[model samples]
Target chain A: MKNSWLALLLFVPYIALAIDTDKAFEDPEMQARYEEITAEVRCLKCQNQSIKDSNAFLASDLRREIRRLLEEGKSNDEIYDFLVARYGEFALYRPRMSGKTLVLWIAPALLLLLGGGVIVNIIRRRMNMPIEDDLQEPTNT
Target chain B: MSRFLLPLAAFVILIPIFMVGLTKDPSELPSPFIDELAPDFTLPSLKDPEKTVSSSDYAGQYALVNVWATWCVGCRQEHEFLMELSRSQSVPIYGINWRDGRSEALRWLQALGDPYVASGFDQDGRVGIDWGVYGAPETFLVNADGIVLHKHLGPLDATAWERDFVPKIGGGS
Candidate 1:
């Protein structure tokens, strides 16, 4: 019992830290929207983490702002526009398709096609090369 | 031989681009509001809670809209510099007390000296969102025409003022 009690004490602090306890919308639809938007929004303070995953104060504030805007009947697109207007396209995890972002969207496919063409060309050239006769007498024999 | 060298040349070109990306601070997201008109907002004044201040009040002069909060450590770091700048009276300074307790914010200014001509209480940080403030201690320099001239992230000091603000204001200050 003493050992178990000590173990519980050690685990209690982690349990406290693990609980988010963030306020949730009463409406399920709004809550869903909140979750979706939070996931889509990048946490500027934690560049790699989504707003939903970040513990930064700015992320929390942004989440709260999103909730408020949702409550005010603002659509998801409007909310996104609001953030983009302020933080620029960097706020969006999936950047919108535009002239500036066209290269970013197309570069991977272009590289893949280029690489495939090179590999195909190399293989074709090797096949076209004269093959050494397997039945030829060993030169050093 | 030229075909093989093409990939090497491509990689060489990408090296500098990748280096630039790696050196940039990812947390410092660029504001889209640069060179655009400052967003309009009306918030209650920190001094007199009953009275409100609007963005229009900053019209007709170069001003600094400093976003700060009592909870933000960076704001505390930059407070002394703001106080000094306020003393210079070179330009009007406005405050957006973002998402902070009203009493605590008032107490902070009272203790440190109020630098803002009118500190707007952005108790909910909505105005701050409009201002494209991702972090506290971000300062925006707005021209007389209400257009945002420059936005400086992180703490502003004398060196930053000379480098970032002086050129925009034509070295007047």
Candidate 2:
């Protein structure tokens, strides 16, 4: 009961946006897929804004088109493929993993590895160095 | 030697990382619409009766074409900047009013002072669509040849005026 209530509370803000997708609720799977797809694609004319955030005519047209395609029972992959073919990769904010975009994909991972390597090198050097106490000893002699 | 090397490497690496973060995204270049021939349109004047304005009117002089709407808060915010810009510059400033009413737009101009040489009313937003206007508060700096020299998206603030606009156009303080 608590989990369901928590889910409802979490979804309250999104509930308003849900009204715009009236046709998507025909099937649970399709609704989920519709949300997933719209969340990725951006509104072309709007400045760095997603289609979901934009109230522009183009955004609305894209939304209507997505709904029409969904009603036609097109699979998520098929819809994405169609859009990618038509608009090119610029349509997506979170761009697809591809050979052309490999640098963008690997950048964060590369930075992490570089940072880890530096930390490991520092640790190794610190471990290998003799302690100041040891170097200054022979006080017993 | 190891201690010195570690700190030196860290210092070098840290500078480049900070530099990378400061670098603007090159792929998302500033307004690719610049230097192209200004898109043509004739729109009604919100203030006057049956008066229409077009791009051809500003054929031989550098003009600052500002896109604004009475409904936009940013437009109101930049009103003073426009006033200041008009006073300081020799170039004529024209306005394209997007998705607004005549009375409301006139009221805004009355309350804030009109900085435009002439303003065009894009009542249905079709004119805006033709000019590639995605939203209000976009400005285009057009050269004497009717070619756009620069396009500034979003609001024109003090920093933009001082750092970008003034130097490029040779305008005032």
Candidate 3:
């Protein structure tokens, strides 16, 4: 009885993990599509969690919808466009490049360039100042 | 002085942007369906499962489509206010009884009061997804042409109706 209880205790976590697994898809291609789409779609109820990771009802509904769309032979872009049309761009984990999101995509590179320029400018100024100091040192000597 | 001024200006400019980001609720995402034609769906009536209700029933009239569930605590909180709104008859209210047991929903309406013209039973929440409902207790205002005017998340109160809804409906509150 004690050995059986220990075995059950060890098996409990695997059961919990299985709960989040997607429903069985008959086609392997459809299963792959399901995995890819769920990973990219954010659970709107839990903004931080992907639909695959979330247990929210909305997430499950979205997963089922994705499966249904895939079965209907809709392309990935069409699926994404459908979700974005209803939930807005926020539904996508990787936002598309558009007029509104142009800044978001460009800002990181712009800031890095600006920072690098500042560092190079400071180093050049330091190098030039040291040359002037070296020249004055000879005079003192 | 010039060196300090550049960073100072950057800091000053960033403060307001950060403040706006901090004040805004990240959970309250903007729905893209606003001003777009409301998605058409045919769902069974909660009371009579055999009969169905569709979006076309509310054509040529401003209507409120309220997504609710018996299990959602927020729905209970807003039920009284919905009842009051139904009594006023300012706009016809339609309910999407989303992902709920039929018997529980029917009993809930009986115990509180039926506020909807017809409550659609969304057994699997397919229609709720079409409406872009992330959570329960989302209310959408549909114009006469079946265009979604606005979507309000969370429990609605008198203040929310006055501020977010009244002006859109052209009724001064």
Chain A TM-scores of each predicted structure, in the order given, are 0.80, 0.69, 0.81
Q: Which residue pairs clash within candidate 1?
A: none
DockQ of 2: 0.10
Q: Write the per-residue lDDT of candidate 2 for residues B1-173, one digit (tens) a residue.
A: 66599779889999998898788653342443466677788988767759988998888878889999988887988889899878876678999988788899998899889999889988766666456565568888887788777777778878886775556566421
**RMSD value for candidate 2:** 8.3
The full ranking of all candidates by DockQ, starting with the best, is: 3, 1, 2
Q: Write the per-residue lDDT of candidate 1 for residues B1-173, one digit (tens) a residue.
A: 87779889999999999999999986776678888999988999988989998888988889999999898899999999999999999889999999899999989998999999998998877788788788888999999888888888988899999999989898432
lDDT of model 2, residue A80: 70
lDDT of 3 at A72: 94
Q: Which ranges in model 2 have alpha carbons more than 4 Å from their true place?
A: A1-40, A43-49, A53-141, B1-11, B15-29, B87-89, B124-135, B153-159, B170-173
TM-score of 3: 0.90
Worst 10 residues of 3 chain A by lDDT: A132-141
- Taking the candidates one at a time, how many backbone clashes does each contain? 0, 0, 0
Tens-digit lDDT track of model 3 for B111-161? 999999999999899998888888889999999888889899999889999
Model 1 chain A: which ten-residue window has the lowest total lDDT? A12-21
- What does DockQ give for each predicted structure? 0.66, 0.10, 0.79
Better of 2 and 3 by TM-score: 3
If scored against the real structure, what TM-score would every candidate get?
0.84, 0.57, 0.90
